[model samples]
Target: MTLTTVLLLGVAAVLVGFAKTAIGGVGSIAIAIFALVLPTKESTAAILLLLLIGDVVAVWHYRRDADLVMLRRLIPAVLPGLALGALFLAWVDDTTLRRCIGVLLLVLAAMQLLLRWRSPDTTRIGESRPAAIGTGVAAGFATMTANAAGPVMTLYLVAQGVEKRRFLGTAALFFFGVNLCKVPFSLGLGLFDGETLWRTLALAPLVLLGTWIGLHTARRLSQTRFDQAVLAATVVSALALVVR
Candidate 1:
């Protein structure tokens, strides 16, 4: 890798930690950074490792705060989506896949906005079973194909009325588990090579540092501000992916 790529990657690693520990959707910035610096396949693999590490720290910090039952309700529906995404990766063309994902995210963001506008109080909407399944499936597919599940998952959790700390805890465990599930396929496809592994190792310290910084920042943020920031970031990220 060139010096510029290395520096960008270090920045990306830090963003991963920050997203995991503090802001849920901000890690999508790391996804965009890696996609900018590396090939699609290599970028996904590198991100997987970094995300797994972040998950560990997040879960460790927020384990007591999450709603384990809600997380569990999401699993069965997610499995089919993951399998479909894996198949799509194996057979679909890259450009088409990107466009499809971009459209999906755009729709998700728009629908979320519409929902909030219709009901400023989101508690009833969050508890709907069908919405959970739909969001979980979409999140599974998005995460598997592009490591872009952050935006979708964030909307679901936020709409569900999860507070900041529980939100962090649930998201941490959720991504950690899904990323772990992705390992065998990533390895089987030869995405986890020595070079990427070394780079991930080299960038590990930045992830920790960023996580620390983000955690402090998150603690100081009001609940309302956190919600707005997450929604805005998700909208921006969806638009970027659509255009990229």
Candidate 2:
């Protein structure tokens, strides 16, 4: 890779770490940056390792804060979603799926925001069976297809009235497991090779550093600002996918 591409990927690598440790909705920026820097297929695999590294750090710190029951509800739906995403990899072009996913993210975020605004005291919207199934399936498909599940999970967790720390911890653990499971599929697709592996190894340290910074950032921020920031980032990132 050229020096400029390396620099860009390096920055993206840091963002991956930061998003995993401190926040939820900002990962789409890393996803977009990686796609911009590398070939599309290679970018996803390369970013995957970076994400796992960050996940390890975040999960290590937040292991005690996860909502086990909510996770149990969300986990079952992901298998079917992953299978569908793999099917998409086989027969569907990226452009088609990108458009569909962008629209889905946008709609979901809008609906969640509207619901929260209209009924500030109620968490039932996200806690319902239908919402659980729908968000879980969407998250799995988005993550599998594009490594872009953060916003969906963010909206769901926020809607459930999960506090910020719990949200970060739960998301960190959730993606950590999902990302690990994706390894065999990615290898089968031939998305990672010697060169990409070396690149990922080189960037791993930066991911750790970013996670350190993120932990401090998260600790210092207030809940209201954190929630607002995540919501804003999620919507903007979703729209970027559509506009691009």
Candidate 3:
């Protein structure tokens, strides 16, 4: 890889960690970076590894705060989504995957913005079975296809009115589980080769550093400002992929 690519990936690793611990949607920016620098399929595999690393830290920190019931409800729904995503990955070329990822990111960002605008009340959305299933499916497919599920998951959790720590905890565990599940599919798709593994190892420390930074930053910013900053950056990055 060029030095620029390496540097960008390092930055993305940090973003992965930060997103795991601080703001879930920030990881979408990392996804955009990976897709920009690497082949789309390879980028998905590479980021999944980094995300798992970050997930370890976030899960350990917020392990006790998760809503087990919600997780249980979502798991069944995620499986079908995962299957669908894996099939899509198996069929698409890099350019198609890249554009698809960009579009998905834009859609997810829009959903988040709309959710924020329409209501603060979580009860109606959170309690609906259909909503939970839809979120699970969407998250599973997004993660499997592009490693871009952070925004989708974040939108769901926010709609459910998950508190900050609980949100981090639930998201951490959820991604870890789904990502682990994705491993076999990724392997079958030949997404993980030696170079990708080595690159991930080299960049792992940045994820830890970002996690530390996120831990500090999480309590400082108001949710509105945080969402605005992350969403703006993600939209720009996503747009680049679409236009490229």
Q: Best by lDDT, which number? A: 2
Runs off by more than 4 Å, candidate 1: none
TM-score, model 3 to reference: 0.91
> Candidate 1's residue-wise lDDT over 1-244, tens digit each?
7989889998989999999989877888788788778776678788998988888898898889878898887877777778777887777766666667767877877887888888877767777888888878888888878788888889888887688888888888888888888888778777788988898789889999888988899899998999988888777766666677
Off by over 4 Å in 2: none
The residue ranges of model 3 lying beyond 4 angstroms of the native Cα positions read: 223-241
- lDDT by residue (tens digit), candidate 3, 86-192: 99998999899778877877876677667667885755876689988988898888788988777777667766666677777788899989999999999998888
User: What's the distance in Å from true for residue 201, model 1?
Assistant: 0.4
* Order of candidate numbers by lDDT, starting with the best: 2, 1, 3
Candidate 3 has an lDDT of 0.82
Which pairs of residues clash in candidate 1, taking residues 3 or more apart in a chain or in different chains?
none
Q: Worst ten-residue run, lDDT, model 3?
A: 225-234
TM-score of each: 0.95, 0.95, 0.91
